[model samples]
Target: LPLKPTPPPFRNHGNFVVSVAELNRWLGERAEEAGAYVLSETVGAKLLVDDDYEQSGERSAGGEASGRDRNAPGRGRSTVIGVRTGDKGRDKDGGRKSNFEPGSDVVARATVLAEGCWGHLTGAALKGLGLAAKDPQVWALGVKEVWEVEQPLDRVIHTLGWPLRPQARFKEFGGSWIYPMNRPGETPRVSIGFVVGLDYADARLSVHDVLQEFKLHPLVRKILTGGKRVAWGAKAIPEGGYWAMPRLHAPGMVICGDGGGMVNVPKLKGIHYAIRSGMLAAETLYSSLKAGSTDFSSYERAVHQSEIGKDLYESRNMKQPFGRGLIVGGAITNAMVVTKGRLPGGHWPTHRDSDQPLLLTDRDKRYPKPDGKYTFDKLSSVFTTGNATRDDAPSHIRIQQRVPRELAEAWKWMCPAAVYEVPEDAPQGSEHVDLIVNPSNCVQCGAITAKGGRLTPPEGGDGPVYQVT
Candidate 1:
């Protein structure tokens, strides 16, 4: 069942996939047609700078003696050197050599950084230019797998839903889906993955664990039961939103794609944004070069005015940790769209209920010993119980409600006292259990022995008794 009052779908399932090889071929053909030189597997090591030149009226600091006309002055030329390693060679230090030698450096009026998530080089270049900012808050981990189903391929279904683990917090976003790309009579293909937030980085759960649980859901299971996994991998997505975007340009360079942290969460994709950013940067560079100006300020202006920038700006207002809410919202919306004609009135109904709590909590049962000992739990129980018995229970009873000392003490008693006991020789706050059935002619039961004959509760007992040491 789906909820009513949903937003319109902004994405089409057909627009989501393209093979890497196919993409590369298309790019190669386009580059050839445009008469642009294309280099593959080359890494940019540094941006070459002629510090001898100044910007506008600014003075130059590092002047080159012979490369310039000893007295002539203005801004000197600057270019980027992309190094290509040659096959199996040795450096001066005798380190193992690379496949290709340093490739010819490209001299350009401006440069664009379109490198994806592996942005080390782009970041390094920016740092050299003193334009990089601190690391961004937006981060995403991509987990994906392609599956071939045994059943006939029918209509494609793209389902987005949260994982099924208790520790899978609503704050750390996750989703699953099945897409039938091939025609009927052909085996269906599906791709599923999730992007979790880094807020809980230290306690991060593996995407594999989430995926396994997702495949077990009734809706997902039906489509993927007999499917054979064909490919799987994960990548990190930079999602700091518009606010996390870094300095788009400097005097001679601009950063794009993952290097600039440009993923738009609302769009469920980043390739379009990445391409648009790159194209705009290229346009600005083309214009600056044509005017014989190395300044790249226009690139930043262009990006901010682009469609991608507008989308990012609108999405920035939405809060972080886009988890279950997105999934629930997407599912409800998509269901309504697909079933619009089948339903009466041609639309789902809607209602508003202010009396409901967004999340449910169990208060009648005692928590586990470890949790019960926590002060928050002790305080919460007392306050909730009192509030429930009030003349008219408050419409919203928060966990922050204060608990009186007496009520807190009573609630503490309901929790096992053993949880609060400290062993005599435990240094401090150490827990130990000891049983003493006798004082004189003691049997000296080894099971009841503590660090220093300290007596505490036995694991299993029928009566309550107290002993002084």
Candidate 2:
């Protein structure tokens, strides 16, 4: 988390790391000083449209689910009036209780969305409202694990190559990271993980299972040999750069951070960009509200002219060529690097990760089994997360009621959480196996979305508990 960690040509340029705990504490002190009332356990289920509030009818909680979707672009003259937080007492399926009262609405002139990659409400608000930019958003799976070790590490480390098999065409698209954490008197801790692009073709390739293989390599295995894994977590990241950023503003709302695709992927950082964006959102909202207007183009103009825009524009085409696999991509990458990222990438069209074809195997090929210490299976990794899902929870993933056998098999291999499965009793190579959902085992890594099982938000406050990841 140092300003820069030897990434080629990478410089902090003032960007730095702050632990989430420190950031939260700082925000709390600031909020308390400013007399801001923070709601911790509430879920903002829907954004209310100013016009629809007066038009009167039973509208669904999310913009798209409701017949009247104000999130859709150019659909109507509806300003975002407020957001409706869900009632805490409602069941998993959202059934109201005997003493049910519709959740209260927080009416604000401006709402800023900082939701990270593929966030439920953010996705709905963008797609339903037709706000997506030229390129579709792409994602990569990043799994992190923390280990408590006896020796202190002198520096941070990052490495590329290995673990990814030959079947995976895009060898350069993923890599490993090892960041050391030192405490004053305690044992040194190392955070290790792998990031694999989701556009990979093989259905059997599991990011969760493969990370164990990454550990078995002598390089990573050495640091982790005597170390005890203390934590585990996973999240999808936005790989699309400026081309994928949605239009930043609408009537009464503006988006910032990951919700607006502010990540500078080539630099491998976004938090600092997010912090800057949040400040811009505040300024844009303040100006609009003071003028008693609903327009938010000021925010868009500011973002396009800010450092965030400059950074994204220069490196916009860097990742797109990698989709063609390592060799061809390597040639293009080197050219761009020499050209300083102004290679006119507009000619190379890019597509969503889901649009990539998946390579299917007949279900008998096997991967090396985990050896417990250097290697691990999926279930045990989920156990270390500490925020494991309840076994009885309702399924939160949305898929076809009766999925085709091929697609079902694909989903089983696609998810790193082991959230989908085929019955043991089903015949091997059979085309009739029912794909079952194990909602409780889910860590919500968002891999299933690439398999066409677009994930929906679980009941509020029901996801991962990050310890040191």
- Candidate with top lDDT is 2
Residue 298 shift from truth in candidate 2, angstroms? 1.3
Q: Across residues 1-469, which tens digit of lDDT does each residue of candidate 2 receive?
A: 2323344534333433334545766787898889988776456767676766332222232223223222344656667766777554455565665655566889888877776776665665665555667667777788878888867666556655456653335333777777777777878888788887787776666676667767877766678888888777888888777877887776877889887988887666778788899898888788888898879878887987999998887777877777767656656866776576777556454466766666665322445587766667777877776654544445667766356566666678767777788778877767666777777778877776655666765655666666567
CA lDDT of each candidate? 0.43, 0.69
lDDT of 2 at 135: 66
lDDT per residue as tens, model 1, 1-469: 3423333333454574554435656877898899987754344433444454211211111111122221222232343423222222233333444532333445555667675653534544444444443433345444455667766445434444455232323344545445554645756676655544433222223343455555556876676676665554445556566655666665666788766767766445687878888888888878888898777777777877887777665555332423335555444434434654222222121111111112212312222232222112222222222211212211111111123222222212212111121123433332222221112111111111100111211111111211100
Alpha carbon lDDT at 229, candidate 2: 83
Can you tell me which runs of candidate 1 are displaced by over 4 Å? 1-16, 51-94, 97-104, 133-135, 151-161, 164-170, 183-187, 201-204, 319-469
TM-score of 1: 0.57
